[model samples]
Target: MSRLRTPTHPTYCRVVRASAWYDLVVTAGFATPWTYVLVHDVLSSGGLALGFEALPELDTWQVLFANLMGSVVVVWAVLRIVRPLPEHGLFDGIARTLFATWQAYALAHGASGLLWLFFGIEVAFGVLQLVPWRWGRNAGSVTNDASPTDGRSDASTYWK
Candidate 1:
């Protein structure tokens, strides 16, 4: 098996926590209609000021989708913040990769240049999160599906 150097435990944990905090702050606004209204305005204004395409006028479907995404991401971020585990980072990285892919697709279809800012962050965090798993080491040599306190070998304990 090819082994790549991975970040130490502390570094990996810090990165995970940082990503969680970022998600909590950024996505919190989209979690509700009241907040999404303000967030939309801010993003639109910012995009225009930066000479990028502003977000289109709000639609019920768009708001609903954004709310759903925001709610799920906020909950996920909270979990990571509460417990910065190696597994959390690995999974979160995978999620970020998926999100980045969709974001890129939207951009290609002329969604908005402002999305580039979020895309960059997602890619950076995703790469950092997956690097440890890509190597033989699972975030400071932490074994996947292994519990330190119990001797169970079930995969259900991965998130615990």
Candidate 2:
């Protein structure tokens, strides 16, 4: 049996919001030096306990990069959580694709296997946000033949 698909707007918004929540929870620790220290230790310990290679010790530059990434991601995640718009999902999906690509590169270069966990999540959320969603027949009482004619660029409605 074919599964029924829901409307694009609410489902896409929820997915975007959910990704933001996940980002907030995960990256919030990396936003500060003290918290990043604790996060690094915990991740290292967890890796060893799980029989995976522990994360490498970070130098000052590495720590700075981590904190900077965390700070930027945390702020972006907040914006998505607050607005949860379709445009946000598109941009976030693009960002996730970049993140997943770099993650794959790091994994190939012998970064900790623990990174695979995050890589998987990045791929999942990226795909979820990037996939096109069809409008449901009952959604906003929109008929299947209905199309938007607003002045927005074609790129915005391309997926629709």
Candidate 3:
């Protein structure tokens, strides 16, 4: 069987940490149920809730679903903060894309202007994670992408 290779450069390490932090901050700031409650009860106007004005009051199952999702999401953010994995960047990109899509849908349905701001943030983070690169670059810059350069196995770098 062939072995799968992934990025091992210090530049890649930087991207991993940066993307993970983005995920952690964004998830904690917006994905938590407490934040939802605050926005729904205090900040919300024009019948808007979670970027959707058309959504009615959540029922029993809906509330349970939200709680369950939030619980897992908080865990995910904490894990990202604790362990920065380059491979998870792909999944984070997918997650951000999905979120941006939903926000875009809400905007299309006349939800709120605030949703656009969220969409922008999501898109930006998604791009950063997907790209897996540093912010700036010069021709002289070089990174060691050689196999096991840091004495850490690829498997150990991810999902541990």
Instruction: Give the candidate number with the greatest TM-score.
Output: 1
Which of 1 and 3 is ahead in lDDT? 1
**Which 10 residues in a row give candidate 1 its minimum summed lDDT?**
151-160
Global lDDT of each model?
Answer: 0.82, 0.80, 0.59
User: Which residue ranges in model 2 land beyond 4 Å of their true spot?
Assistant: 1-7, 133-160
In candidate 1, how many Å is residue 1 off? 9.8
**Per-prediction count of colliding residue pairs?**
0, 0, 0
Candidate 3 accuracy as TM-score: 0.60
- The prediction achieving the highest lDDT against the true structure is 1
For model 3 the local lDDT of residue 4 reads: 30
Model 1, 7-63: lDDT tens per residue?
A: 345677778989999999999999999899999999999999999978899999999
Q: Which residue pairs collide, candidate 3?
A: none
Residues 75-99 of candidate 2 have per-residue lDDT tens digits of 9999988777666787888899999
Worst 10 residues of 3 by lDDT: 135-144
lDDT of 2: 0.80
The TM-score-based order of candidates, best leading, equals: 1, 2, 3
Query: Which tens-of-lDDT digit does each residue in 1-160 have in candidate 3?
Result: 2223444545555565676666555445345556656544543463455554444464556555656656666677666566656655657777888988988887888765756766898898788776653433434323324426554545443432
In model 2, the clashing pairs are: none
TM-score of each: 0.82, 0.79, 0.60
